[model samples]
Target: MKTIKKLSLLSLMSLSGLGLAQYTPQWTEAPQQIDLVDMTSFKSISQPVNSEQQAVRFHYSLLGSDQLSDNNQGYLAESKQYWLNTNAQKLSQGLQLPVTSDLAVIRINPLNPTKSSQSLNQQDITVQQFDQTLSVDVFADSEQLKATGMPVSDYTVAFNVHTQPGMLTLSMPTATKALAKGDTFIIHVFEPNSEYVLQLKTSQQQYAANQVVKINSQLLSQSGVNHMTIAGYITQPNGEKLTDLSFQQNKNGDYQATIGQLTGQSLAHGLWEVHTIASSDINGLKVMRDVSTAFALSLPTARINQQLAVQSHGLKLGLDVAAAGRYEVSAVLSGINAQGEKQPIAMLMSAAQLNKGQADLTLDLPQDLIRQSGFKGPFVVDHISLKNQSLMVPVQQLSAGIQLMPLGKPMDQDDLR
Candidate 1:
């Protein structure tokens, strides 16, 4: 039985050749000590090369702190170097071939003797030859560790070698300002590697409650053009487009438009829909599909401009005119009672010039007319009518001040005598 055991051992050794003995080459005392606390305390050593085949060998030591060592001896009294054939047998049974630096882990417990240290706990350090340089990395168990720390505890360390290529970053542009209803916005995303299709998503806060508004939906072309259409409907009660809506083109090629006059008639109460649709222009045809969000429309107030006031002596006289033009203003004195009935009053004429901001008019009241009518205190100015025009403004509605000047204190005939 002893002879059979010896023969089996010899057969196994012969099959593996003497190279298996060199598989885990032992190392003597290393001269230098490494400090784990210093991250930069790393030393590079050349790996042994196998001439018979493409193989790499790594030998390393883990030293203890000088204060922790007995008799000031290093933590790792002796270390071993391990050889791995890069082109020889496969490291694992299922693997196709051996890589230059394939790492394996082994565990050992110095205190335990019944169990083999190989199965207890162990780490494999691989040295790989890449072109003219060597790469080294360590693997323990199922985890990988760098050579920067000792193997006494569970930790990860990594070592890498490669040429760094230039990098480019892409980012989206910030929104310019608050968007109004029916406004169009363009968004851009930059990428260099390949063309990408992106979909934009907006928050619920962007839309009104219970209102459906279409947000942005569009495809950005490689030319950086975002092709999409956005629109918002005014749904507030009496919501109308603002008057005098205009778009002004600046010297910088920017477009600005005043959202026309808004009236209560155009908008419905509550939430409105403001949406964007992204369409692709296939050939010349447009294919619009996606919709976005619901927005709210607020009611707008009406604006009033032209105003006037008319007064004669102490009684308020309502005057009607025959013609009113852009720059021409005319007023005719007429009689009207509280019942809105026309009474026969002496004909009076007043003239004024009208401009963009304000219209100034002067009414000369004849003393004879005032005296004959026995007009009394503080007369109110009634309606002011433009000559030959339909834009007749009521005197009560006029915002400008109206002054009644008594016709040049009727020239005294006695003074002339």
Candidate 2:
């Protein structure tokens, strides 16, 4: 009887309505967020006079993955980096240290970039575990700092806080000072490449494998931006740069780029790194902001309704996929208690009609289903599955600093009858 029960349990978790994972309802995607560490006045500590270590704290957010995986994956990990330097090197290079780990390649890995022959003040450092917050212990000789004219001269030390592979939570070029004294002096804080905060947005988080994805950019801080251009390449899981992509400001200062196989370009389904280079003219002073965000390229792309009100016969929606086949809409509720195998319950499926690769979809989500499943919070209209294709939306809400990675597949049959 015990063996039979175990078999039943495994079989129950294998349910795949609309080609979704058995644990679709068990997952939730939150909009990624970031916290920038202000190194300008964050802290000032003299290098330990006798090689004593001082710890500095860094706080952050949005390092967790939204998709469901059987493996226990997390954003935090051990890092041997977290530099405190005066060379004024770029933080983006620090971003690549985890993958490259080439101290020689980074160039700034040396204790002193000025090629000073003194090892006394050549910073001794220890990197610890990274979470939403982290601490680094830096040891510097006071005499060595004074020898280098530090606190009296106001030399700035920088840190590159790597949150994840492509996502950076906080990076302050001059976030802290290893040596600080009561006397005020020349504070050597290098200006950031670009003071403008640019955010990349898409119509939806997920897309079809061969879909022509739309790119939307917003200058959160629009000051000092006379003109700007966006340039970069997308890196595939295979360590390949898909192509050199770029975009410039239009007549209305609108900048955009369309990339995919549909436009004589190549974009496949997998995790991708989008490295962006923005050169903007601030008061005629051209500055550059080089950063990157990540998302997944998928198949059966569609538009998701973020703020939908409950209707009598479910909510009507639209999709940006080929409008040729019958589509099935599915959903999973959020903020509810998991009781038995019924928590992530699949609602009654609804059929969708299409016109020219567009969907006027209304999934049959009745009040009975909501009450039965104990769905107290919002519902994630997760994905759309059809006879020939399916699309997965990794996130339900579009918030600031969020990175999207949606997935899709072709050849689908109803997992739930």
Candidate 3:
């Protein structure tokens, strides 16, 4: 009767999940967020030093500037490179330059000219706004004159213009001269005592739909300013303004803004931008600067269930999916080796489309791998992670490891499944 009872107990145990030990997944606290874009970047135009006579250089590498500069000419020749830097704008035909003072000095540097050193004279060179001709002076560029292959016409020409309060259009007649395939032009607009640097930053580049975003902007100057203000707004992926950002100066002397609890309500899932403008009154002159930073936003759509099972075939875990999406789970099978030291045996990954609700995913443990690891009784599942392939976002991770009991040997080829 005792033997019969023992046989009955064995049968009950065998009829169960047919695995070894059950384990509860131990997940890490607050998994590190993913980064889909650059976290921190800086862009600033340096002050030209001598403020009274400083000129903001607007340089353009037109047509073939890169090729003619190198012996491998035409190999890399491309169309004109427009000026996209701060404080300068490239118009349809010429440049739209800003003037901050009544008196300004302008310099034009022609590069890779087709004429001889003396063929193109400065008397023929002229600059006009609408229809008025401005007086100009010819000055040989010591740097270009020292250059081996540069023509004299390609040297620097300087001009002093009087009176200006707003934007200035510096244009050359369409019949002045045609540029060579490799030629370029330069325009230097002098804005005296108008250089102030501003830098913008964000805490991270990628944020979940429910996470808050933090931003900071810093302004630097030579002396000090009387009044300074900074403000910004958010632009959605569709190029529509979402909300306004109000920045307050903190104790650390940096302007900071706490974005939001990005929560609820369907959001446009893509790259979002933060555009800011900072203005200051320096020595009675109003200076303003604009800057922008971009970051990626994603939705959390899946999660790994804490209740996991250990079976002879492998490890089985449940997923509590919030949305229907292609989800993936991966883990490292680790166990004690012959030396009584724990080590990784095999890496396993499984992915499938899981609808919202409870779904079972299996991390098949190969019999050969288990046999090779030589674990005596119990094993472990380390570095387990669940990710949404459809949305390409990592939803959950368990780094503390799940303690699993040693799996029983496969019963045959059929058990390998």
Question: For candidate 1, what is the lDDT?
Answer: 0.26
Give per-residue CA lDDT, model 3, range 1-417, as digits (tens).
898767766665564344333333333343343322211220111111112322111112111112111111111111111122211122125555545456556565555544532233455445554356656643445354547454434455555665344455665433233333344555545434443556677776555555678787776655532245988898876576889999988776778887775522122344577887666666555555666777655445555656566555657777666666566777766666577766666667777766677886788755555554456435666666665665554555544566663244534333322
Local lDDT at 34 for model 1: 14
Q: Which regions of candidate 2 fall more than 4 Å away from where they truly are?
A: 1-195, 218-225, 262-270, 299-330, 333-382, 385-417
- Expressed as tens digits, the lDDT of each residue in 155-190 for candidate 1 is 222232221111111111111121122222111111
Candidate 1 residue spans exceeding 4 A from truth: 1-348, 351-359, 386-417
* TM-score rank order: 3, 2, 1
Q: Number of the top candidate by lDDT?
A: 3
Candidates sorted on lDDT, descending: 3, 2, 1
lDDT of each residue in 1-417, candidate 2, tens digit only:
898667665554442222222111212343222121222331231111122122211112211213322221111111111222332223311222221111111112223222232221213222222343333223333343467665522222323322222222223223123222121111121123223455555454444444575554534344422456667677764466878766656565556666875211112244566666555555444334445555554323233432233334344444544323333444332223453221333423454434444445555444444444453433444433322121222212222111111233322223222
Q: Could you tell me how far off, in angstroms, the CA of residue 271 lies in candidate 3 after the best superposition?
A: 2.1
TM-score of candidate 2 relative to the true fold: 0.34
- List TM-score per model, in order: 0.16, 0.34, 0.43
